[model samples]
Target: MKLLLTSAGVNNKSIHNALTDMLGKPIASCNALCIPTAMYGHPWVGPGVNAWEFISGKSENPMVDLGWKSVGVLELTALPSISRDRWVPLVQETDVLLVSGGDALYLNHWMRQSGLAELLPALQAVYVGMSAGSMVMAPNIGEYFASWTPPGGGDEALGLVDFAIFPHLDHELLPDNTMAAAERWAAGMRGPSYAIDDQTAIKVTGGAVEIVSEGNWRHFTP
Candidate 1:
């Protein structure tokens, strides 16, 4: 599977170009499945979804533009009540899974409960994770933030990626202490870890990782 874990949105023209090159088509040219509900309570959800609007040139819900045909906007405030069978077709048909930014723990909890943790890796589609979406793939979510309690229980994560990723570093848009917290957390890790600045991303393909962009990328290995 091809995975693009970006620190933020696809706001950089150069990054956008690189991503299109990597994915082999204009982002808008491909059908995208956006999980904007990942950012549930954030103010950015509206704007972030709007950004996808500009990207896809569709004023309607950006999720629709991604070719979902039927966009499922699930409110994961609690344990998922929907059956996994209902999402099977959508997951199978999507060309790209675009998980938006939000509270990492919350997103992680929902993904785990929804059974997407297992379903995503088995799919044929490309996975595009941003911010909180990126964090869920790591083995642990503690490095990214203090703690997040989902409605059902304590929030761990899906553990898709083997390493921890700290996104949105050195970006004024993030909380002032985020970077420091990540640095401290990474310092104690026993496996590979990354602290990616806002403009950067780490693309993992065929078990190899390449840090992409013009910013400081720090790696920690124990």
Candidate 2:
């Protein structure tokens, strides 16, 4: 699978171009499945309106709102109860997975529990993760970003990517996530990390990484 990790969604032309390049086609011809499970575990997000907004393309975060050939919802929590035949084929046919922001840990937990994490290694789909969705791909999210705790009680994630991410850098609404705070978060990462603004995105394919930005970003080394 290919990864397009964004602080926000494809908020700028550069990131949008990156997405198009990853898809190797216009988004209008691609099929998408949006995951809204992460929002339910976050205090600031929801099990209600915020989740609905994300799925229904009403959220201002700029993900599902982007035009697609078709869009469907894949709630990770519900995957466990249904047979694989019922949903696995649906996933395999989709061109991309659109993930939302909220609690990274919670998203990670569900990704594992829902069998999605295991399936990811073989999928021929692009993964476009926003905020927590992006962070879940890292080796760890750090304690600073921890919201919901998983049963294992660690800040671990899928570790699909070797580094970590400090998203929404310098976002006005999240004053504490400034560069200074990101620096502190990076120090404990023990690997490469990035502080990216809403306009920035990191693209990873075949283990190579590139920064796609139309705004501010900084690479941090531990």
Candidate 3:
């Protein structure tokens, strides 16, 4: 499996290159399935508003700028009401899975409920995660800015990666995502944890894990 887990989407040349390299092809050749499930629970957006547009600005959506052959939005919350057989094929055909950021627990809940978690491990598509999207790929997410309580009151994440990821350290806008707060949170984690800024990403391909970064990051273990 291959994952390009980022605190923010491809914000710079380094991240863009990292994603392209992981794809093993030109960006224009790939087709992406953008999963905006995490944006569903955002309180900032009122009911009846377009959550994807609110959470993912057109410019910030890397798939659009990367020139993918097609970029389709797959809202995981609507899966239970639809046919899995019909949609599973869309996932199978995509070259990349681009997950947006929001509440980590909410994203995790939907991933399980939508059967996306089970489908992910075997998928040939490269997983591209942004913030909470990246956090949900871990075994668990240590406390940070977002105050999320899982629907089942569970702390477990997808466990796609062995460790927890604490993203957006020292970010400009997110005041709560500070190094002090991250360090404090990481101290309580049961396993290893990584604190990464927006410009950084953790790339994992099978057994190989490497930090592809342009900003500050730190690894913590308890």
Candidate 4:
């Protein structure tokens, strides 16, 4: 699967271009699936207006709003009650997956439970992730970003990508997301990590990783 992991959802032209490249076609021609499951697990963004905003394309982030041929919801929590044949083909046929931000561990839990985690590696579609959606691609999000932990417990996520991410760097509302704080967060990580602002994204295709950014980002080596 192609990955376009962003601090915010396609916030800048560079990131948008990267996503286009990953899609290998125009955004208008592609079909997208929006996943809002992560929002419910977050303490601040659970089961209300935030989830509605994301699904309706009215959120501050720009995932579902990106003008696709069609946009559908793929709520992870609801997958268990349904059979795979009904939804698996729907997922495989989609051109991309627009994942929302909220809680990384929580998203990771449902991804695993919903069998999406196992299906991801073989998927032909692009996976675009915003904030915690991007963070869940990492091995672990670290304790600092942990909220709504899994029943088994820990900050561990999908581990789809080799590195970790600390999103929303230096945003006004998140007072603790400064470079210094990011450095502290990086200290506990076992592999490479990145602290990126809203205008930045990390693109991974066929095992090659690249940064597509219009704003600030810092890479830390372990």
Best by lDDT: 2
The sequence of per-residue lDDT tens digits that candidate 4 reaches over residues 11-130 is 788888888888889999999999999999888887899999999999988889989999999999999889999899999999999999998998999999998999999999999999
TM-score of each candidate structure, all chains considered together: 0.77, 0.98, 0.92, 0.98
Task: List CA RMSD, all candidates.
Answer: 4.5, 0.8, 2.0, 0.7
- Candidate 2 lDDT, 33-63, residue by residue in tens: 9999889989998878889999999988888
Assess candidate 2 and give its TM-score to the true structure. 0.98
Model 3: runs farther than 4 Å from truth? 44-50, 54-63
Select the stronger candidate by TM-score from 1 and 3: 3
Determine which window of 10 residues in candidate 4 has minimal summed lDDT.
147-156
Off by over 4 Å in 4: none
Ranking by lDDT: 2, 4, 3, 1
RMSD of 1: 4.5
